[model samples]
Target chain A: MAQPIISFNNVSKRYPGGREALSNINFTVEAGEFVLLTGHSGAGKSTLLKLIPAIERASSGTILVNGQSISTLSGRGIPYLRRNLGLVFQDQKLLFDRSVFDNVILPMLVTGQSHAESTRRVRAALDKVGLLDRERANPVALSGGEQQRLCIARAIVNRPTILIADEPTASLDDEYADAIMEMFRSFNQVGVTVLIATHDRDLIAHSSPRVVHLQRGRVLDKATA
Target chain B: MNALIRHHLHSLRQSGVRFASAPFAALANMVVIGVVLALPLGMYLLVSNVQSLASSIPTEPQISVFLTPGAAKTDVAALENRLRAVEHVRSVRFVSREAALASLKRSPGMADVISTLRENPLPDAYVVTLGEGSAAAAERLESELKGVPGIAHVQVDSAWVRRIDALLSLGRSAVILLSALLSLALVAVTFNTIRLQILTQREEIEVSKLIGATDAYVRRPFFYWGGLLGASGGLCALLLVFLAQVLLNRNLSEFGNLYGVELRLQFLPVADAALFLAFAALLGWVGTYLSVSRHLSKIQPR
Candidate 1:
C-alpha cells in the first residue's frame, strides 16, 4: 500500500487565551481516502484542517504530508506546499470584486499556468461546477449554493492532489448540500483525497463515510464505514 | 522564468486596471505629487537661470589706474604699456584728462555742471581689464598695479560682481534645501497612498495568501501601482514647469526689452527631466516596498 497522503502523530494546538484547540491528535489519511471530521464548535476541527496547509502549526508533534515533515517548511516553502492542496472554507471566501471566471483562474495564475492553458482549464473547472454560463458574472451576484460551487471550482482549478474543506455545506439547503456532497464524491472517485470537517450528523448518517469525531480538544471516536 | 515574466506583466496590467477604475482619485493623487515636485524643481531652475544671467553681464570688472598729478602724456603712455604687460592685465585703455572731461560734458545732466568748473580737474587714467580669475586674483593685480611709479590710486571694480556671485551661491544652497524637503514630502505621499491601497485590498490580499500566493505575488501589483502613480506625477510636474516657463518667459522678455537686455529663461534639461522621473519612480517603489513588506506580514490566512 502507498504511504498515507497525510499523517499527524501526537499533534497538539494551543491558541491564544490559553485554550487548547487540539490535544494529542493522531490520524493518518491515505491517498484517495475520503474522511469526515465531525465536532461541535471549538472542537479543533478547523484547527486540524488549518494545520495541513501550515496556516496553523501544531504546538507539539509531527505532521507528514506525502512523506515530507511540514515542521521543516519555511516561509518560502509554504506556498509550494499549499499549491498542492485544494482548500475550501465554509464562508465561501470568493473575491466578489472579480468575475466568477477570474476567481476560478486565480489559483492557476498563482501557479503560473500559460494563458491559453489557464483559459481552457478555467472553463473546464467552471463547467464542472455548473457555472460555465455565469463565468462573467461577479461572485456577489451568485446565489449561496452557486457561490459555494464557485469556491469549489476555484479550489480544484489547480488540480491539487489533496482537497480539504471546512464545513463546506453548513448553510446550504438540503438539496444544495446533497449536490455539493455528490460533487465531492465525483472528485474522490477520480482519486483526489478529500477531508471535510463538519458538525452535520445527518450528513454522517446519510453518506456513511469514515467518521472522526472530536470533543473539546481530543478525539472521542473514530468509526470506519 | 516565463512565469515570472507573466507575473510582472500581470502586475502591470493590474496597475492599469486599478488606474482606470477611478481615474479622478488617481489624478488627484498624481496632481498633489506633481505640485509638490514642481515647487522645488521650479525654484532650482529659477536660481540656475539667475546665476547664468548674472554671469552673462559683459562688464569686464576692471582696475582703474589713476595717474599721479602732473604726470606727462609720455609718462601715462609708458605706464599704460607697462600695465598691459602685467600677467593679469588683459588690456589697458588710456583715458586722458581731456577725453574724460569731454565725456562728462556729454552726460545728460553733467554738461552744465562740468562747464561751470574753471579748468579740467580729472587726471589721466588707464582702465585695466583683468583676465578671467577670482576676486583674490583681482586683488593681486590691484596690488601689482599700485606698485607702478606713475600710478596714484589703484581701484578694483569687481565689488558689484562679487555681490552677485555671493547671492547666486546662496540661492543655490536654498534651492538644494528646498529640494530635499520636497523629496521627503513626495516619499511620504507615496507611502500613504500605498498604505491605503493595502487597507482597501486587505480582503483580496488575504484570499490570495490563502490560495498559495507568495509574498512577492501579493506585492507585485501594488508596487507597480505606486511606481505608475509616481512616474505619471513626475510627467505632470514637467508639464507644469514648462507651462510656467512659457508664461514667465513671455513677461520676462517684455521686461528684457525694456531693460535693453535679452533675457533667456531655461527649463530643466532633458537629462534632468529624465532623472526626475526615474527618481520619482524610485521613491514610489521604495515607499511601496516599505508599506508592503511591513503590512503584508501581518495579514495571514487563519
Candidate 2:
C-alpha cells in the first residue's frame, strides 16, 4: 500500500564513448524487502547499484529513492542521499592506514555524530558484524572475509535504511560466504532493506528472497519469493 | 552544535597527528617557510631602525653665510638683522673673524697653526637656523642669501640629511618588493606540501567520499594542517629575526662606540608579530584551498 522505497522506471545508463551499461530497467523495492540481483560479470549489476546512489547518472528515465528523484539531485544533495544508503563495493574499500575501528567510524564522522554516540554505535555495529574484538587491529591484518565484514560494519554504522552490496561474498570459502550471507540475513530480519548483487547461483538458490535477474544490460526476470 | 565542535577538534587533532608522524619532513617545510618570510621581515626591521636613528639626530636645517674679507663690522651686523627678518628663519648668530680665530686657537692642534698667521684668515660669517627643517625651504633660503650684498657663499648644511632620507625611502620600497615575492614563495611551498599529502591519502579521500563526506569535511584536516604549518613558520621567522637582531646589535654596539651613539636594533613590535602570524596562516589557508579544490574534484570513486 505504501510507496515503494526504491522505484526505477525505464531507466537507462550509457557511459561515454557509446557503451550502454543498463537499458530500459524497471524495478520497485518495498521498504523491508530483501532482493538479490543475480547476473554474470559485465551484466550491469554494479552499474545498476551505482545508479541508486547517483554515482553514475541515468542516461534516460527516472530513479526515485525514498520518493526523491535521483536524476534531479544536485551535487550537494548526493552526499546526503548517500548518508541514508549503505554501499559495499566488490573490492572491500577499507582504509588500511587506520585501525578497523576507525574505518568503521568514518560514516559517523562524516555525518558529524556526537563522539560518545558514534563510539557506541560503532561498537554496536562491530559487534553485529562479529568484529568487536578486532576493533583496534589494522585493516591490513584482516583476512579477506573479515575485511568484507569490516566493510559491512562501516556501511551499516549509520543505521542506513537501505543496504546495497556488490559481490559481498566473492573470493571467499563456502564457510566464510555462508557466514556473511547469514549476517546479511540477520540484518534483513531486523527490517533493513537489503539488495545484494552476486553471480553465485548456489548462493542465490539458498536464499528465499525476491530475485532480480539481469542478462547483459537488460532485466531478464523478476521472480517473487 | 556539540557535534560540530567535536568534528572540528577531531580534524585539528588529525592534522597534528600527521605532523607528528613525519616530524623531519614537517620541520624542513616549516624552516623553509621561516627563512623565506624572514628575508623581508629582516629588511623591514633594518629600514625602520635606520629611520629611527636618523630621526634621533638634530634635524634643524641651518645655512652658513660667509661675508667678504673686506666687509665692515656694520655690514656684519646688518647681515645678521637681515637673516633674522627672513621668513622661517628661527635665529641668527654673527661670528666675527677675531672670534673665529679665538675659537680655532682653543683647539689642541689648531692653536700653533693659528699663532703663526699674521691676520685672521677666516671671513666673518652668519649662522642662520631655520624653523622649518625641510630641505626645499633651506635650499630656497640659501639661494636667496647667496645673492645678498657682502655675502660670498651660502652653504645648506641639511644636504646630507636629505640624502639619508632618500636612501631610507629606497630601502622601504625594497622591503615591500621582497615581501611580496617571498609571500608568493610561502604560498607555493604550502601548495606543494598539501598536494603531496593529498596524494598519499588518495585512498582515504575516495573512501570518505563514498561514505558521504562533503567536500568541506574532506578538506577540513588539510586546511588545519596548512594553517598550523604557516603559524609555526611565522613563529620560526620571528625567532630567526630576533636572533639576527641580537647578533647585529652586539656588533653594532662596537660600531656605535666609534660614532658615540647607542645603536641597538629593536625586535619587531607585538602587533606586527601577531599580524605576521595571521597573514602567514591566511596564506596557508589559501594554498590548501587551491590544492584541495583543484585536485579533489578530479578524484572520483570509480
Candidate 3:
C-alpha cells in the first residue's frame, strides 16, 4: 500500500579495471517487504546492498531510498540516508574493547544523539534483542551468536525504516542463524523494508518471502525454471 | 567545536585502552619533542640575556677631537663648548696640551715613550660622547667635530659597539635557525607517534567505520589523545625548562661564589609557561590532525 522504500534505476557499477560489476540493474523493495538478495561471491550482491544506504554511489544511475535519490545526495547527506537504513555485517564488526552498551549506542552516537537519549534507546534496542542484562559485557566475551545479535541491535538502534543486512547469519550455527532471520522477520512484520543479502535461503525457505536471487550480478528466475 | 573536541577525546580514550601495551613509545615521543623544543628555547633565552647584559655596560661610545698646533686657546675653548652643545655629544672634555702630555706620560704602555720626547708633541684635544652608539651618530659627531676651526681630525671609538651588535644579531639568527629545525623535529616526532597510533588503531577504525561511525565520531579519541600528549609534553617541556634554569642558576651561583658577586640565572616566566603549553597543544593538535585525517579517511573496511 505504501510507496516502495527503495528503487534502483538503470544502476551499473564498473570497477577501475574496466569490469562491469552490475549492468543496468533494476529492483524494487517496498515498505513492509522482506526481500532476500542471494548470489555467489563477486556476483554484485554486496554492491547492490551497498547502494541502498548510499555507501557506494552507482556509476551510471540513481538509487532512491524512501523516495530520495541516494546517488545524488552529498557526502553529508549519506548519514541521513543511513539514519533511515540499518546495515549489519556477518563478522559482527563490533568494537570489542567496548561494552555491549557502547556497541549498541554507536549509530545513535554517530548521529550526535544526546547521551541520555542514546542510553535509553540503546537499552531498549538491547532489550529487543534479549541482551538487556548483557549491556555491560564486552563484545569479546560474547559468543558468535551473541555478537551477531549485538550487531543487529547496533544496526537497528536508530530505528531505520529499512534494514539492509549483508550475511547477518553467515557465521552463526543453525539455531543462531534461525534466531537472526527471525529477528529480521519480526522487524519486517512490523512494516520495515528488509532486504537481506545472504546465501542462507534454507533459514527462510518455508516462510516464502519475496526472493530476488542473482547469478553473475544479473537477476535470475529460479521459480519458473 | 567543544562537542567535536570531546568526541575526539573520548575516542582517544577508547583507543588508548588497547594502546597501553606501547606506553613507552608514546612517552618517548613526548619526551623527545619536549627535549628538542627545549634546546633552542633555552639557547634563545640565554643568548638574549647575555646580549642584554653585555649592552648594559654603561660606557658611552665616544669620539676624540685633537686641536692643531698654534690654534688659539680661546678658539679651542669655543670648539670644546661647540662639541658639548652638539646633539650627538653627551658631553665633551677639554684637555690642554700640557694636561695631554702629563696624561700620555701616565699611560701604562706610553709612559717611557712620552718621557723620551723633547717637547709635548701631543695635541690639545676634546673628547666627545654621543647619546646613541651607531655608525650614523658616530659620523654625525665626527663631521661636526672636524668642522670646528681649531680641530685636526675626529677619531670615533665605535669598534666595540659594532662588534657586540654584530655578535648579538648573529647569535639571535642562529637561535632562530636552531629553533626552526627543532620545531620541525618536534612536529615530526609527534606526527610519527600519532601516525603509529593511527596505524595501530587500524582495526578499531575499520570496525568503527564499517558500523556507521562518522569520521568525527571515529576521530574524537585520537584527537584527544594527541591533544593530551601535546599538553603533557608541553608540561614536560615547561618542567624541563624550569629544571634547567634551576640547575643553571645553581651553577651561576657557584660561579658567583668564585667571583664573589652572588649572581643567578633567570628562567622562563609564567607567561612563557602558558605560551609553551599553547605551543605544545598546537603542535600536538596539528600532528594528530595530520595523521588522523590521512589514516581515518582511508579506512574503508569493505
Candidate 4:
C-alpha cells in the first residue's frame, strides 16, 4: 500500500574504462521488506547496493530512495540522505585507532547527536551486537567475527530506516555467518528494511526469503523461468 | 546548541590526544618552526634597536666657528657675542687654541698624539648651539655664523650622524625582507606537516565519510591540531628569541663598553609577540584548510 522504500527504474552503471557493471535494472522494494541480492563476483550486487547510498552513481535511468529522486542530490545533500541509511562492509571498516565505543558512536557524532544521548545509544547498539563488554577495547584486537559484528553495531547505531550490507559474511565461518544472519533477521523483524548482497548459496538456501538473482549484469526473469 | 558544543569539545580533546601521542615528533616539528621564525625575529630586534639608536642620536646641531690661525683674542671674544645674537642660536662658547690643546691632552689616548705636535695647531673656534636641530635650521645657522667678522670657516658637525642614519634605513629594509621570507617558509613547513598528517589518517577519513560524516565533521579535529601545533611553535619562537637576547646582551654590553658605546638590547615586545602567535596560528589554519580541501574531496565513500 505504501510507496516503495527504494525504486530502481532501468538503472545502469558503467565504469570509466567502459566496463558495464549494471545494465538497465528494474526493481522496487517496499518498506520493511527483507531482500537478498545474490550474484557472482562482478555481477553488480555491490554496485546495486552502492547506488542506494549514492556511493556510485548510475550511468543512466533513476533511483528513488524514500520516495525522493536521488539522482540530482548535491554533495551537501549526500550526508543527509545517508543519515537514514546504514551501510556495512565485508572488510569490517572499523577505526582501529579508536575504541569500540568511539567507532560505534561515530555516526551520532557526525549528525551532532547530544553526548548524553549518544552515550546511551552507543551502549544500546554495542549491547545489541554483544560487544558492550568490549566497549573500551581497541578495534584492532577484535576477532574477525567480532569485528564484523562491530561494523553492524556501527551501521545500526544511528537507527537508520534502511540497512544495507555488502557481502557482510564473506570470510566468516558457517556459525558466525548464521549468527550474523540471525542478527539481520532480528533487525528486519523490527520493521527495518534490510538488503544484503552476498554470493553464498547455502545462506540463501536455508533462509527461503525473497532472492533477487543477477547473472553478469542482468537480473533473471524469475516469473518467466 | 548542546551537540555543537559537544562536538567542539570532542575535537579539542582529540587534538590534544593526537598531539601527545607522538610527543617527540610534534616537538621536532615545533622546533623546526621555531628556528625558522626566530632568525627573522632576532633580525627584527636588531634592526629596531639600530633604528632607535640612529634616531636618538644626541648630537645637537652645533656650528663650529673656526677663525683664521693668526686671529686676535679680542676678535674671538667679539665673534662669540655676535654668534649669540643670531635668532636661532641657543648658546655660544669660545674655545681658545690653548684650551683646545689642553682638553685634547686630558683625553685617555689622545695625549701622545697631541704631544708630538710642536705647537697647538688648532684654530680658536666658537661653538654655536642652535635652538632647533633640523638640517635646514643648522644650515641657516652655519650661514649666519659665516657672515660674522673674523670667521674663516663654519662646519655643521652632524656629517657622521647623517651617514649612520642612511645605513640604519637600509638595515630596516633588509630586516623586513628577511621576515617576509621566513614567514613564507613557516607557512610551507606547516603545509607539509599537515599534508603528512592527512596521508596517515587517510583510512580514518574514508571510513568516517562512509559512515555519513560531513566535511566539517571530519575536518574539525585536523583544524584544531594544526592550530595547536602552530601556537606551540609560536611560543617556542618567543622563548628562543628571549634566550638569544639574554645570552647576547651580556657580551654585547661588554663589547660596547670596549668601544665606548652603550648597547641596550630589548626583547620582543608584547604586541609583537601576540601578532606573531596570531600569524603562526593563521598560517596553521590556512595550511590545514588547504591540505584538507585538496585531499578530502578525493576521498569519498567509494
Candidate 5:
C-alpha cells in the first residue's frame, strides 16, 4: 500500500579499476520491516549498505530512499538524505578523542539539535544501549562490545526512520551479539525500518526476519520468514 | 536562527579550546605573523612621523623677484604692485637693499662677511607668496615675474620642500609594496597551519561527514581558528610597533636635546590599530577558506 522505505531497482556498483561490488542488485524493504543482508567477505554486503546512505553511488539503475531518488541527488542534498538514516559501520568508527557521551551525541550535533534536547536524547540513547554509566569515559577505554554498542547509540540518537548497520555484531562474543540483536529487535518493534548486513549464517538461521542473500555482487535469493 | 547562532558559538569555543591545547605551537605561528606584519607597520609609522616633522618646518613655497642694480625705488614699487596682481599670487613684500643688508648682518656669523663686502652688492627684492604651494605653480609664477622689465632674476625658493615631498612619496610606495608581500606571507602561514590541523583531524572530519555533517558545519571551527590566529597576530604586531616607538623615542629625546628640538616617534592611532586587526582577521579567514575547501573535498569517507 504505502511506498517502500527503500527500493533498489537493478542497482549496480563498480569500484575503480574494474571490481564490481554490486551487480544488478534489486530489493525493497517496506516501512517497519526488519531485513537481513547476509554474505561472505567481499560479497558486496558493505557496498550494498553504503549505497542506501548515498556513500557509494549506483553505477546503473536507481535507488529510492523514503520516496527520493538517491541516484540524482545533489551533493548538498546528501546530508539531508543521511539525516533520515541511522548508519552503524562495521569498524565501529567511534571517535576516540571524545567521551562516550560526546561520541553518541554527534548525530544530534550535526543535525543542529538544541543543546538541552540533544542532551536528553543522548542520555536516553546511551541508556537504551546500556552505556549510560560509562558516558563520561573515553571511547578508547571501551571494550569491543561496548564500543560496538556505542556506535549503535550514536546511530539511533537522531531517531532516524531507517536504521542500517553493517556487520554490527562481527567482532563480538555470542552473548554480546545476541544482546545487540535484541537491541535492534526492540528498535524495530517501535516502527523503525531496520536493515542489517552480516555474514553470521547461524545468527540469520535462528532469526525469524526476511533475508536477502548476496553472492559475487548479485542477489542470490530473497527468502521471506 | 537560534540554532545557527548556537552552532557558531559552539564552533568558536572548539577553536579556542584547540588553540589552548597547543599554546606553544600556536604562539610560534602567531609570532611569525606578528614579525612579518610589524615590518611594514613599523615602516609606515616611521614614514608618517617623518612626514609630520617635515611639514612642521616652514615650507611655504615663495618666489623671489630681484631687481637690477640700476633700478629706481619707483620701479621696485611698481613691480611689487604688478606681482600682487598676478593670478594665484596671494601677497608680495618689498625688501629694500639696505634692509636686506641689515637683516643679513643680523645673523650670528654674517656681519663679518657683510663688512668685508663693497657698498651693498645686494639688490632690492619682492618676496611673492602664492596661494598654491606646488613646485610647478611656483615655477610658473617665477617665469611670469622674470618677464617684468625691472626684474633681473626670479628664483622659486622651495627646492628643499619639494625634495622632502618626493622622498615621502617614495617611502609610502615602499611601505605599500612591503605590506602586500608580508600580507601574502601571513596568509601562507595561516594556510599551512590550517592545513596541518585538517590533516591531523582527518578521521574526525570523515566521521563527521558520514554522520550528516554539512561542509559548512565541518568548516566552521577551522574558520574560527584562523580568524583567532590572525587577530592575535595583529595584536602582537601592534604591540611590537608600540614597543619600537617607545625604544626609538627614548633615544630620540637624547638626540633631540643636541639639536634643541623635541623629536618623538608616535605610535599607531587607535583607529588604525583596529583596522589592522580587522585586516589580519580577514586574511586569516581567507587562508582558512582556501585550506579547507582544497583539503575537505579529498577526505570523503571510504
Candidate 6:
C-alpha cells in the first residue's frame, strides 16, 4: 500500500481578530486519492490548502507532506515545496504577455529545465490538454473552459505528485464544470493525488469520493463504523 | 538553463517594451549625472588653472627690498652682492636712485614734474630674489636683510603670493564639499530609477521567484542597467568637459593677451577619466543593488 502523501494532525489557525479559522483539524490523504473538501464559506477549507504549501503556517500541531514536516518548512523552502506540489486556481493566474506554450512551461522554468526539454514537455502538455495548435495564442483568446484546462496543464507540466485546487468549478457552468471534473478524474485515475475544495453540492451527489465536511472551523462529518 | 533565462528575458520583455521608454529614462538619468559632476569638475578646472597662473609667476625674483633714501649707490651694490651670497638668495639686482628717478621721469605724466624737481629723492634699492617659493626661505631672507646696517625697511612684496595660497586652500575645501554632495545625488538618482523599475515589474519578479530563480539571477539585468547608466553618464560628462576645454582652448590667445599669461586649458587625463567612469559604475551597481534588495524582499508569495 502507498503511504499517506498529506497528513494534517491537530491543525489549527487563528486570524488577527482572534477568530479561529481551523481548530484541531486532522486528516490524511493517501497516495493517488481524490479527496473533496465540502464546506460553506469561511469554513477553513482555503486555510487548510494554504497550510500545505507553507503559504500559511499552522498555529498549533503539525502537518506533514511526503514524510517532511511541512508545518516547519521555512519561507525559502516554499518554492521547492510548491515545485513538488501543483496548485491550480479558478481565476488562472497567468502572465498575460506570454503565449499558451510559455504559460504551460512556467513550472519547468522554475525547475531550471533545459530549453529543448522544457519546450518539448510544454508542447506535449498543451497537446494533452488539447491546446497544442493554440500554443502561440494568448490565454485571453481562449474560452473560459479552455483557460481552466490551460491552468491545469500548467499545474501538471512539472509532474507534481500532489495537486491542490481551490474552488475549481465555482465560476463555471454545469457543462464546463462537468468537463473540468472529468479532466481531474482522468488525472487522478492515474497516480496523481487530487485534493479539491468546492461548494458545488451536485458535484459530490453522484461521485463516490470520501467527503470531509466542515462547519465554521470544525469538522462536522463522522465516518460510520 | 536557457529555458528559464529565455522566459525571464522575454517574459518581462513585454514590460521592457511597454516600458521600452525605460532606456530613455536611463539616458536622461545619465545626462543629469553628467551635469551634476560637471559642476564641481568645472570649478576644479578653473581653480587649477588659476593656481597655475599664480605659481607660474617667477619664483626666482620672488621678493623686493626697497632701500632707504640717501643710501649710497656703491653701498646698495655692496648690499646686492652680500644678499646674493646668502644661502636663501638666488640672485640680486642693485637699482641706483638716479636710475629709479630717471625711470619715473620717463613716464608721460611724471616727465614735467620730475624736470621741475631739483633733486632725486628716490632711494637706491636692492632687489632680492629667492631660489624657491617656500615660507622658510622668505623668513630666512627677511631676518637677514632686516639685520643689515643702514637698511631702513625690508618689504617682501610676495603679498600676492600669500593671497593666491589662501585661495588655493579655499578651493580645496570646496572640492571636498561638492564632491561629497554630487556623489550622493548620483547615487540617489540611480536608486530611485531602480526603485521605480522594481515597482513596475513586481509581477515579473514574482514569476521569477516562482520559477526558482535565485537572487543573483534576478539581479543581473538590473546590474547591467544601472552600470550602463553610470558608465554612460561618466562618458557624457567626459564629453562635456572636453567641450569646455575646447571652448577654453579656442579663446586661449584672447585670454593670454588680456591676462598676459598663457591660458591653455586641458582636458582631464586618461587615468582620471578612467577612474571617474569606474567610480560611476561602482556607485550605480551599489545604488541599484540597494533598491532591488529592499523592494524585492518585501514581496513574498502568499
Top DockQ hit = 2
Q: lDDT of candidate 4? A: 0.85
What are the per-residue Cα lDDT tens digits for candidate 4 across B120-161? 888888887776556678887777766566788999887677
lDDT per residue for candidate 4 within A92-205, as digits (tens), equals: 777888899999988998888888889999999999999999999998898888999999999999999999999999999999999999999999999999999999999899
- Greater TM-score among 1 and 2 belongs to 2
List candidate 6 stretches off by more than 4 Å. Answer: A206-208, A222-225, B1-24, B44-61, B64-133, B143-166, B207-223, B257-262
Pitting candidate 5 against candidate 6, the one with the higher DockQ is 5
* Model 2: per-residue Cα lDDT at residue A127: 97
Best candidate (score: TM-score) = 2
- Model 3 stretches astray by more than 4 angstroms: A222-225, B1-22, B54-60, B64-87, B93-127, B133-158, B257-262
DockQ of 4: 0.59
lDDT (tens digit, per residue) of candidate 6 on A44-67 = 888888888776789998999988
* Global lDDT of each candidate: 0.87, 0.89, 0.77, 0.85, 0.89, 0.78
Clashing pairs in 4: none
lDDT per residue as tens, model 6, B1-302? 45557645643454345436667776688899888878777777777777777777764436667777766768766787777777767667777788989899776568888888888877777777776656567777787778566588787777567777788879978987997888788888889988887787777676666544556556766776777667777788878888988887878968676745556876667897899889877877888888887877886555
lDDT of 5 by residue, A25-61 (tens): 8889999999998888999999999998889999999
What's the lDDT for residue B103 in model 2? 89
Deviation from native of the Cα of residue B276 in model 4, angstroms: 1.2
Clashing pairs in 3: B7-B220, B8-B220, B8-B221, B11-B221, B12-B221
lDDT of 3 by residue, B1-302 (tens): 35455465556666576347568876786687778777877787788677767766754677878878889879976776676676656777777789978876775567877778888787877777777545677777677566678878778776576777788889899998987777677677767877877787687777556555677776777777777677777787777877888888888988878744666666667797788788877877888888877767776766
> Per-candidate DockQ versus the true complex?
0.66, 0.74, 0.29, 0.59, 0.65, 0.32
Superposed by TM-score, candidate 4 places the C-alpha of residue B180 at a distance from the truth, in angstroms, of 1.6
Worst 10 residues of 5 chain B by lDDT: B128-137
TM-score of 4: 0.87
Model 2 chain B poorest 10 in a row by lDDT = B128-137
Worst 10 residues of 6 chain B by lDDT: B10-19
Better of 2 and 4 by lDDT: 2
Encode model 5's per-residue lDDT on B74-139: one tens digit a residue: 877788777777777777888889999999898666888889987998888888777655557787
